[model samples]
Target: MKQARPLPQYLVQRFQGWRATTFGENRSWYRRLAEGGQHPRAMVIACCDSRVHVTSIFGADTGEFFIHRNIANLVPPYMPDGQQHGTSAAVEYAVNALKVAHLVVVGHTNCGGVAGCHAMCSGHAPELEEKTSFVGRWMDILRPGYERVKDLPAENQIGELERQAVLISLENLMTFPFVRANVEAGNLSLHGVVHDIAEGTLKEFDPVSEGFSLVG
Candidate 1:
């Protein structure tokens, strides 16, 4: 297979122009963000996909959200021992260090990572273990969520899978001592959200309805 070429120089040059636009137009805000520590109202766990930026999706300004992005936006259960756990560490810092008031686990429809769950649960791709692909390991986090909702209709499985995975992550978020303490004390709230990339609409999980509904 031919190697993919790098982004063209014109696009790279345009990147600087975009940054300059933000920097030049928002100089005072950038300076404040640099000098004063971030005090975001919410912490968002989002996907690493280039198209699914949480800030832009939420129409947020600088320093509005403490954000962490990983494959499929999955968060693992807490572990006490030190590990190179990028996702967990981000949660710890956002909740404990930054003390954000809200934590949102944002899943999206038609996600490549969630779709990969069907293959993972079926164990049809053994080659994944050898390649050590990032998607393979990250998909493992969804196994529990998959098992919980596997009996649902094939068409509905992906939606339930994504939603339940966010719920699992929200539950896992509480495993961290700080998050648990803060949430139990009513100082912090947890939310599960799903974004439809094609439509540019957001749906948040409603405990009363026991399903996802439009956020607005």
Candidate 2:
């Protein structure tokens, strides 16, 4: 039998330090959380980018927010097919089961997945078009978003496309019956946000203005 590789020494040391410090100081809180189960009020869908820190940005505690991260923070339109759908399933659980009050889709600048989608759609990355390319297949969900911003100059398209990811996800989230029902019933709200990674700034979508506004 093949043995599983052990975790890296650095990670082990970090975990030990956390266990001794942060975990130790909050032991009772952790215990209470374990016993009570999670009751997060908000559900955040964010990019897999390491720079996008959802909990830190909101100053959220351990059990305050239910977070789900995926490539480009894209939420595909609801498809009730028998096949597996990780993002949709999470949304269903968050809205139907957890009853989160708010659903936020957070996109970020300089997203590699968005850039790859831009490349693939523009015919610059022919390799991604192959059926065997998982990234390409997954990114195809963002094709419509790309089309919406294709007219922009090459230099500006990426940033616009990044914001489009959040917008698209927000739009797609409504396609889920559970999400729409909760939202229309005033039990849930949907939000779209874009983070400028390098500048450490955020822009929130304004449904009234139909555009994103800087958060002061």
Candidate 3:
């Protein structure tokens, strides 16, 4: 019979440290969150990159935001064909059930997923083009974004592609009927942003100007 392995020593130590410090100090807060359930004010759809710390960036307390992390932070156009859709399910729950007022799609610089999509589009990453490659299929969601940036010089494409991913996701988010209903009703707001990981800065997208403005 197969068996599962225990967590590594470092992770165990880290968990113990958190329990003794962060959790210890906020025991009541944690209990209240557990009891009251999560009623977050916003929903953040961000990249799965480890450096993208959603809660820390916003200085959010526990249960303050419903976060969904995915490769390249891409959300496919709504297709209710009944196949498994992790990202769609998260958005649906956050919008319909949680009724979050704000939905933020965050992209970032030097994203590996964006790089992979670029490579595949340029025919440099053939392995990613295989039909059976899950990452390839997921990255396909960014093809429209790729088409917009493919002609840019090599050094510039990645950065622009990353931003494109955010815009693409924001556009895709509207395809969901529930999200659209809430947005049209003025009950939900959709925002797009790109983070420069090294500089610790954010560029917010403006629908009127169709450009990204650096946030002070």
Best by lDDT: 3
How do these models rank on TM-score, best leading?
A: 2, 3, 1
lDDT of 1 by residue, 1-216 (tens): 479898899999998897889778988988899999789999999987787878878889878999899888889988877669989888889888898999999998778788787667866666544457777777878888889878888788887887877887887887888889999999899999998888998999888988789977
* RMSD vs true structure, all candidates: 3.3, 1.0, 1.1
Instruction: Using lDDT as the measure, name the better of candidate 1 and candidate 2.
Output: 2
lDDT of each: 0.84, 0.93, 0.94
Q: Return the number of clashes found in candidate 2.
A: 0
Predicted structure with the largest TM-score when compared to the true one: 2
TM-score per candidate, chains pooled:
0.89, 0.97, 0.96
C-alpha lDDT (0 to 100) for residue 26 of candidate 3: 97
Provide the global lDDT of candidate 3 against the true structure. 0.94
Model 2 reaches what TM-score against the true structure? Answer: 0.97
Better of 1 and 3 by TM-score: 3
Instruction: Give the residue spans of candidate 1 off by over 4 A.
Output: 1-8, 129-131
Model 1: pairs clashing at backbone N, Cα or C within 3 Å = none
Estimate, for each residue in 1-216, the C-alpha lDDT of model 3 and write its tens digit: 368789999999999999999999999999999998889999999999999998888899888999999999999999999899999999999999999999999998889999999999999999999999999999999999989988889788888999999999999999999999999999999999998899999999999999999987
